[model samples]
Target: MTSLKNVQSKSSKSCYVIFCCCTFIFAPLLIGSIIYQSSGIKIPTILSSINATFSVENLIDSPTKIIATIPHIPLESFICDKINISRFPVSSTTQTNDSFDVYRKNVLEKYCDIVPVPRYNWSSPKSYTENDIAFVIFTAAAFFHTRTTAARDTWVSRITNYYFLSATPYPYLPITVVPGAGEDKLSNMKKLFYGLQIIYKQQMNLSPDKQQKWFYIAGCDTFILPHHLLKRLHGLDYRQPIRVGGHWGQHDCPGPNGTKFQAEFPSGGAGFFFSMKLLEILQPHLTNYVENVWPRNSEISDVALSCLSHQLGVPLTKQVGFWAHPPAFTLGENGRDKFHKEPEPNDFHYIKPDEMHALDEFYIYQHMDRLINDRNWSEFTQFMRRFVASHYELLRKKRRECTLPTIEAEVKLSNK
Candidate 1:
């Protein structure tokens, strides 16, 4: 009887220990998630905070730090929220003469009508307009005449506050030189970080009337449709901390210390966005993060920022329609038309100079709604499929390109 009593006591003690361990290990995470999801307030994760602070012992213990750092952002704001192209929704009785214009004139020219601009009764007193969005475009000396020019001529004009940055500046062009940014493997990454810093500083100095509510960060190689982009932003709550993009996945950055740090980030080429509230949170941390964290960063600005954001508990909310590559390369992969069959895309990356012009003109002349008349669009669709086949290899990259193979995306944010 004594032996049986001892066994029962031991089993009960073991169970108690196991339960304690589990509660200790998981309770904070569960609580943190619940609070964050419910309130949209980012609670700086204790573990992530500790990891970053100690990542560089040199700074943590040193009294003379590189710069004064803002320890944390108050959990005041957090909010959250891409592209594909389709053909023929609106038609103009008078369409510009292009190769495709000939096709439209022969078939659906008479049916083409200008789409009426949408008017919204906004809940906020201030509605989002072209002035409300600022664009920060990454470019290089090599692309100044080609990609940059194409972008300027096409969509870059809508917003008054647009910046083109490069490591090597061409005074003749709109591109500005980033201090200490080099034209190396990590050039684009450097540009990304420095560009944000520029936006934060420049926007903060602007008068209230000129301040931007949203910021779009993209490469010069990307072709963006301002109309569609604004449409997407219109539905979002700009007052909250919002980070929206297409490319998102975990990436590993191996430091000189031989440790591999991982972060989930959006790809830079297709473009990403930040709400004004997010920019304010990030602005105070940029100097500290660049000084302390850049050394251990993935050397990709997007991934590096993702790591910093992870520490600060910022989430990358994903959206569809940010096409990774031009239609020619991606059209037939998931069965031709399967991708375009979806909603009209906002942007396309990995496009050539001519391709940018072609796409810009297409969207300008051809209407984007597939629901207009299936019969008319079907013929145009078949023609585009043949065009895709004939021009399969529009531009070839000497180095392997960093592109998301699919347009598939997801919202990885808290419930709010």
Candidate 2:
């Protein structure tokens, strides 16, 4: 009986230990769950903040950092939201007059209606006149974090205020907020092509001379625009049907480090306008090539598009200064290291810290109440002035200022 009693006692102790172990293991988890629910915390948002903060440290922290460095954009933001492009006009062949006019007309005539005057409310308010061209920008949210409600409010406020206060309206330029699915990141991009096809078929079913216009897939963050490229397009055979793509920055090439460290492709963040004829051809074939190697995942979207175009047997037009190759905004050599090299007059430049904070401030202004709050409001307002003013000289002058090529080459290599 004594031995039986000892065995019972041992069993009871084991049960108690098991209960304690479970409690110890689950206590924090239970608490975290309650807090997460109560606080309305999104795991992705938290994770994005955590992920974006790591930077260079992550690349070196071996496999641990690599495993933790998954992209953390919110799930709500990832689900591809439908955006209607029906209102975007695709009329080609209105004029064959001026050389510059004919060049732009031929290149852009197929997928866009090139009018001398701005018909849409989406034109830049400051520059919107009777003769400004109306081109639609797509899925621009990735380029403009300030426009994203989840990013910096200051950035949102600045862009809005600049456009609105400046009296601008970006009407038909609907930003696609969702990330699409495919074997590659760009598999979802095919949906854009297919969606355009559906919209085009629905609209242009009637007219034999239905003017298909140019489709500008603009990268918002890039700040370069190559004028020589515009000049070159004038020389292409408009009847042959041509499409343009690339970084389309303001400068000549990627600064030093950008060329080396960054991916080289026909398209990138600044924006590249494609020919409507190309889209019409690719629209039908997009589904078959969704998993093809060209649209596969990579650091550069334009590069992927270029690759996909090649795989689909589409030819991409090559031109000098087409994409501002190195991109003056993010990865360029000129404006990146401001302390070391002075920016030329025309570069749309931002300081490193300023660029980082700009998106956050934009988010605060767009989605939160920091604008009215004194602490954030003052800082944000000053930031706007400085940010806008930094490029004020260039905007007013509108000159194509080129830096010394030797200097450009040197800055191209420096990552900073």
- On lDDT, the candidate that comes out on top is 1
- Compared with the true structure, the alpha-carbon lDDT of candidate 2 equals 0.36
| Candidate 1 lDDT, 123-234, residue by residue in tens | 2213576668888888877777678877766566434568888877665445667877676656766677777887678877988767888888888889887656666665
Q: After TM-score superposition, what is the CA distance of residue 413 in candidate 2 from its true location, in Å?
A: 63
Q: How much lDDT does each candidate structure score?
A: 0.60, 0.36
How far residue 43's Cα lies from its native spot in candidate 2, in Å, is 56
Model 1 bad stretches (over 4 Å): 1-127, 253-262, 295-299, 336-338, 367-416
Model 2, range 1-416, lDDT digits (tens) per residue? Answer: 44777767665665565555556555765676677567654433323323212212221222211112233223221111111221234446553343333333333232111111111111111312111111322333233324222212222222321111001222322233223432233433543444455445643674644443445443333332221123334444433445555333221222234341222345444345455566666666555544443324433445545545554555666543332322233333434343123211111222233333432332222222222322355545654675566356434333433333553334456577
Worst 10 residues of 2 by lDDT: 114-123
lDDT of 2 at 349: 20
- TM-score for candidate 1, please give it: 0.56
